[model samples]
Target: METILDKIIAKKREDIRNMTELTINDLDLSREKRSFIEKLRHTSEMAIISEFKRASPSKGIINANLNPAEQGALYESYGASAISVLTDVYFKGTFEDLKTVREAVNLPILCKDFMVERKQISHAKAAGADLILLIAAVHGKDALKELHEYAAELGLEVLVEIHDDEELEKAVSIGAELIGINNRNLKTFEVNLGTTEKLGPLVRQSGAFLISESGMKTREDVVRAAKAGANGILVGETFMSADNLKQTFRDFKVPLTVPQR
Candidate 1:
C-alpha cells in the first residue's frame, strides 16, 4: 500500500518524464533570483513566510477561486518577508502559480513541493523560484544533501524540513542554513507546536535560522514559537482561509504581549 508521501513521489517522477521537453541547458540559469536568505536575515517582524496554497491533500480545494497573482500582491503589500508558492499538482498547484506570484510580488518566492530529482530544481528556477523546500523525512540524509547542493549550484536557497530529532541531526550535518521545524506529522497529520519547542535547542546549537512551520494560528502561537527560539514562521491555512487577507496579516504582525511572571 502506498502512503501519501509515496504517492506524491510517484507523481513527481511522472512530472519529470514530461520534463524532457525542456533540458537543463535550455533553462535560463542566469535569471536574477531574489535572495530568500537575505530577506529572512533582514526581517524583524517575526519573519512571516506566507504561503499561497490553493489546496492540499489534507484539506482539498481551499480557495480554488483565488487568483495567485492577486494573493501574492496582497501578501507583499501586507509585509510578508517571503512568499511560498505550492507547485505540487497533487495539491492543486502548478508552476504557473509560482511564476504568476513571482511577477506579482517583489518578495522572494519559495517553491513548496516534494522535490525528488535534480530536474525539479531546474523546474523551480524555470518557474521563478528563489528557494525550494526539501523534506528530510521523504529524501533521507544523503539524498537531501545532494538536492540541497544541487539547488545551491543553481543559485536557489533551500529550506530543509525536519519533523523529528533524527531528521534534525541530518539537516544540521548537511549545514542547512534555513531549517524548518514542522509541527505537523506527515504520517498521522497531527499538529502540535511543541515539536518546535522540543527541537529548538538542537537547532540553536547548529546555528541555523529556525523556521517554525504549520499550526501557527494566532499571535499567541507566534509568541510561543518565538520563545522557543524560532526566528521565522511559515503560515498558510490561517491566512489563506481569511476573508480579509490584509487584516489577517496585520493581526499576525501585531507584537504579542508575553505574560509577566
Candidate 2:
C-alpha cells in the first residue's frame, strides 16, 4: 500500500503532467513582490504566519468552504505577519487559491506545498508567492541546496524546513537564512512540539531565523516555542479550526500586547 506521502507525490507528478503548456520559462517572474523575510525580521508583535489550509493528509478536509480571499483579509486585519497558502491538490488547494489570497492581502504569502521541482518554484513566483518551503526530509541536503538556490534566483525566499539534528546541520551548512523546524514527523504523521525544543538551539547556533511549525494551538504553546528560540511561528490548524479566527489570533498574541490606559 502507498503511504500518504507517496500518494501526494504521485498526485503532484500528475498535476505537473497536466500543466505541460506552462513550462518553467513561461512563468511570469515580474510580479510585484513583498518580502517574507523582511516581515519576520521587522516584527514587533507575535510573529505569526497564519495559514490558509483547507485539508491535510492526516486530518483530511478542514474548512473546505472558507473563502481564501476573505480569510486572508481577516488574518491580515487581525495582525498576522504573513500568510501561508497551501497549493497542493491533495490538500484541496490550487494555485488559484494562492493567487486569490495574494490579490486579497498585501502581506507576504508563502506557497506552502511539497515543492520538489524547479517548475514548481517558477509556478509559485508566477502565482505571487513571496516565499517557498523546502523540506529537508523530502529532498535531502544536496537537492535542498539546489532548490534553495533556484528559488532565490527566481526572487523567492525559502523557508528551509528541518525535523531533526541531521536536517538542521544540512540547513546550516547551506547557510540558510530562514530555517523552520517542523514538529510533525512525515513518516508517521505524528506531531510532537518537543521536536522544536530539541532542534531550536541548533538553529539558533546556525545564526538563522527560526520558525516553529505545527502542533501550536494556544498562546502558551507559542510562548514555549519562543522561549526555546523560535523567532516566528507558522500556525495553521489552530487558526483554521477556530470558530472565530480573528478572536483566536488575538488570544494567541495576548502576551505580546501592551496594557491600554
Candidate 3:
C-alpha cells in the first residue's frame, strides 16, 4: 500500500527534475554555522527545536497565516535551541520561508523537507539552512550514506530520522551523530510516545545525540521524552497552536533527568 510518504517522495522527485542547478558558490558559506548538536549537548534542559510549520499531511492547515520570520524570532526570544522551517510544497511551505526565518533569527535553522537528492541539500544551503532532515525510511542504506556524506561536505548537519529499530540500526551503521526518533510513523501517521521509550536508550547508548520528534505537547510529554533519554525534542503543532507562544515554549523546557553517555 502506498503511504503519504510515498506520495511526498514522488512529488519531490518531480520537483527535483524541474530544479535548476545550484553550486557551493551560490550559497552564503561565509555565514557563521551554529551547531545544533552542540546546543543540545550543553543544555541542561530538554532542548526545544521549535518549528515554523504551516501544515502537514495528517493535520492540514495548522496555521496558514503563520509568518516564518516573526515566528522564528519568537522561538529565539523564548529560548528555542533551534528553529525548524518546513520547506515542502505539500506542507504549504517554500524555501522562501526558510530564508525569511534565517534573516530574522540567529538560531540554527533546520530546513525541514523530504530530502532525496544532493540538489535539494544545495537548495537548502542556498536558502540559509544550517541543517537538513534525511528520513531513514526514504532511501536505501547506500543512498542514505551518500546523502549524509554530501551534506557534511557542504557543512550542513544531518538529522537522520528513524521510525523503528531497523531504521535506527541503519542510522547507527552510517555513523549518524544526530539521530531523531520520530514517534509519529510516516507511513501510518500513528503517534505513540512509547516509540521514544523503546528506542531512546539504544540511541543514547550508541553515544549519539538523541532527539524525540513529533507528538510532543504538554510538560509531561517533554518529561517523558527526557526520561526516555532524549537530549532534545522537535515540536511543531503544539507551538504553532499555542495561544501564548513564549509560555508554551518555556513550559516545554523541562530538565533532562537521564545522564548523557
TM, every model: 0.92, 0.92, 0.98
Compared to the true structure, candidate 3 yields what TM-score? Answer: 0.98
Model 3 weakest 10-residue run by lDDT:
22-31
Model 1: lowest-lDDT 10 consecutive positions: 252-261
Clashes of each: 0, 0, 0
Q: Which stretches of candidate 1 lie over 4 Å from their true place?
A: 21-24, 254-261
Clashes of 3: 0
Task: List lDDT for all candidates, in order.
Answer: 0.85, 0.84, 0.92
- Candidate 1 residue-wise lDDT at 86: 93
| Best model number under lDDT | 3
> In what order do the candidates fall by lDDT, top score first?
3, 1, 2
Q: Please give the RMSD to the true structure for each candidate, in Å.
A: 3.2, 3.6, 1.0
List, residue by residue over 5-94, the lDDT tens digit for candidate 3: 999899889988989888887877777989898787677888888998889999999998878888898899999999999999988999
lDDT of 2: 0.84
| lDDT (tens digit, per residue) of candidate 2 on 93-159 | 8999999999999999999999878888888888889999998877777888899998888888999
